[model samples]
Target chain A: MPVEDLYPSRNRTEPAILDRQDPIIHSTDFSAAPISEEQLRQYEEKGFLLLPEVFSRAEVSRFLNELNQMQQDQALLDSEVSITEPDSGALRSVFQIHHHNDLFSQVASDPRVADIARFILDDDLYIHQSRLNFKPGFNGREFYWHSDFETWHVEDGMPRMRALSASILLTDNSDFNGSLMVMPGSHRKYVSCAGETPDDYYRHSLQQQTVGTPDNHSLSYLHKQYGLESTAAPAGSVLLFDCNLMHGSNGNITPMPRSNLFFVYNAASNRCVAPFCNQPPRPEFLATRETFDILPQRSASQDRKAG
Target chain B: MPVEDLYPSRNRTEPAILDRQDPIIHSTDFSAAPISEEQLRQYEEKGFLLLPEVFSRAEVSRFLNELNQMQQDQALLDSEVSITEPDSGALRSVFQIHHHNDLFSQVASDPRVADIARFILDDDLYIHQSRLNFKPGFNGREFYWHSDFETWHVEDGMPRMRALSASILLTDNSDFNGSLMVMPGSHRKYVSCAGETPDDYYRHSLQQQTVGTPDNHSLSYLHKQYGLESTAAPAGSVLLFDCNLMHGSNGNITPMPRSNLFFVYNAASNRCVAPFCNQPPRPEFLATRETFDILPQRSASQDRKAG
Candidate 1:
């Protein structure tokens, strides 16, 4: 597949050009870069690699409009959307967007996402879980540092760390907004940071999908070993992180609202293995059991009519 | 097993007894009554039926202790629990309890929950989901009226309304605290009160999980057809309702807190068919795909040491 748009846009015309010290942590695996031995090596070293400008500005604009239309739909405000701030009742995070919104479904299972997943997963794959997270400015929330795989392994019946998540920044993720922060090289060891899965919530709500994080003492120990880095990429950047990589985000305190789509991918062979755990794994929406081959890439942003 | 504990103690010495006009709504399906052709007919007419004292007071006591312990646990509060109010950050609800706490796992799979399922689903079945919803007094949140099946069908790929939920009361549901409210016989016809599933919140937050309610016109029609009734029952009562039954609860302003453990069951014949619809269904914890036959109902409350 053609990785970079040779014509280039006003923002990232020469795709995959990294401004080594641009302060923005962009990935080495973009359209031009693709998945190579070197890029894999870099991901291994850093635990996460950022892909800058996975979509053109036009594509990002279309997505933003569709999102706005859905959010403002009064019908939706009263029923389906939930709030993170109970007092203010402001929107925080959403789930199953791909199922409800056709555009998102395509974006969620886009060839790009599948392509990247195949590089790491190295086998047929399917989406285990998908969600859209928004860090609203000023009233945003903080996701404490922890590993995603910790809960997946213990609760979701995921047997190994073969799965990973792609954080697609639909908006410009500035430092002020709650951008994703990760502890480099933390994935080397499986940190049992998740003290216990509050097995009750699994049946009641989807809050327990992201496993719990480590304690301060253990966190400090890890921090001492591997320094932390915040992802400050522009709009449309795709960040792929190992499932076990320790990561989190700060509450947005600025006027900039940050949002992203996360799609978790797992190899087909690595389905849930509940074994002896009485608690059942997550539902199909969050941790899908079925696996499908990577879909052929259709011109996602080009489908203007669908958009 | 002895249907009733002949030798009465501080708790239920007998499995079930009826004080006819206890003010609390008791099921006709208690010990004196079991699921029969008559009860099924009544359910078809009412859209919901009550089953009282599924657990003994001693069992409820142990469960209550565990819930209290979890809510107060600093480690749990920090890692596993999910809060509704971001600023005050009070405990609103919890998820995955069945996974973390063994007591909850058994309670989630209680035979009582399955017995009701057998009558409704009419086939071999499995747990679709389990959760503990707490309407804490004063700080409790309101659950706007809506149907659970609407969301499951549109979002979770559920093919039929062969599923039902048993809201097992963990605490006495008084008028002051939030209690399960329903519009009788609403399940006979699929209201389609929910218009197009606003796919936006599905990604932005969990609001879309329970598809929002109908507009004023449609709601008025529903109300006119089937008036609302509050499920004010004592602790251990089980309120079983059809999947499409329109239901919700008002926010609790009273000092009494209302909590319930809901276990959803679905017939094995039906499963999710996520065809071309873009939006994905619920996560594994909220909408499980795997099917397991009913577990033999051991005394869910009797597993002492674990509790």
Candidate 2:
């Protein structure tokens, strides 16, 4: 079926934005038509699941165009954008534009996306950050195999809260174009590249000896041993995966640009500390009514009737 | 006394080479003479201990000169180097120069420095990655309060194995000069950050968050509540602290640059993964006869005569 047919008409409008007068429900009701339990289990076991046709081709194209334009503008302002080495591939400036765009904000707060997060996390959720990974065909380098959680855990200690990640493909995805490769259930076995010793860890050639890089081979071997699946979903598809899942992708070998929008959300009750950029939530973004009201509503009538 | 007069002239003869056969043992014995049981306990409770005159003035100056020269050369080749806006007070570059120099390798295996690591870690140790942090007068930004172990645990999720860190100051450290400020024993309590969520942990922005910026009043309040101590040690001093300790530094408000070398070490038995950069130990630096001779002789001597 055409991807467009799967999406409800744009006129359908997202469930009307809730207001302050409407009672706020902090609890999540997973009983509603949400991601299936089977899917959730698969994610837990394999570390990742595919939600195909999450974005229509048109939407993906729109995002890609917007990203390209932003990159062009940033290149003019900062030479950092143009300083790509053949070894590192493209050194695109991240965190520069998407934070301000509406499309990004919409995807970040999309209820459908949030529903999947709620299902996996089994709780209310908050959008932690949005990322626009721009992999231009000309400068794309092969990303080594590793886990996102490995990187995150490197910055903070192991956290118990269940976490889920959703990657929205803003352009057509294929093996030729650096589609993400994930090792199923690798998240359950959390291992550092090297052992707890600094000597065991791999240090980047340029980094000081005490620091080590994530173990790429360990990840690849695990994926091979476990028979992990790689989702080469088309554009507009979203891949929801366990945060600890071992995954990475090679550079886009195709002749076209590969862009994707990544939205990360954590359980509402989970302690939220900002990750990479030091900036806190802009006061305006926090003030949005959508931020306050998008949580699952459990009215007395609905609760009693359902019960 | 002039800085040069503070050390014996013969100190320069060794040039801080690592013994290959028992690199771990040789490295940890050089400074072991001065480390007392009381000092070890103090380090455990306070999170960090300063070692004054660990390096001679000549050694420190030599390292600083090398770093400054490397930065200048890198700036010409890669345009990533930049001066801060409004005031060109701080020069910033994220260049990785480990492959080009042997300084880091020497520091990583320095016997005097490793001896202290072994004493605190209570086992054979290996070098992790190292970095040169040079904060020119009034140029560096204030560091946030956080723990290295907290960050690393998120990445490795492995059992703790004598993880420790050392900071060697090559310049005079004072309150006005960007000396380290640490909260003793805060490493015992781990706090969660936004990036800890498994989902979207790899998103670029997730990495950008700081532990607690200087402007964060809450951090100050917590530091006060935690009985944090700001350290001011002289040049050639070394501070060895637990990886989990909460620490950070203020900007170098003084007129001169504050240069320091950070060496992270873990127990030798620990398995390390390779870093993103493919640089591993060159066969020549791996093991040496000196290490083999010293370790066995020392172990035998101790067996024959208990202290």
Best-matching candidate per lDDT: 1
lDDT of 1 at B204: 26
Tens digit of per-residue lDDT, candidate 1, span B25-58: 1233444333656666767777788876767899
In order of appearance, the predictions have TM-scores of 0.43, 0.38
Cα deviation at A261, candidate 2, in Å, is 0.4
iRMSD for every model: 15.6, 20.2
lDDT of 2 by residue, B1-307 (tens): 2111111111221211111111212234334443666666677667677777777778878877876776677443354222222245344322223223577656655666666666666667655445566676423544445556433433333234256778888788764444777777655544333312232332221223332111233334445556546577888788888766767654432244677777677665543332111123212112111122111112222212111
CAPRI quality of model 2: incorrect
Candidate 1 off by > 4 Å:
A1-33, A73-86, A203-211, A290-307, B1-307
lDDT (CA) per prediction? 0.61, 0.50
Write down the DockQ of candidate 2: 0.01
> Looking at candidate 1, what is the lDDT of residue B54?
64
Candidate 2 per-residue lDDT, tens place, A160-183, comes to 335567888877776444567665
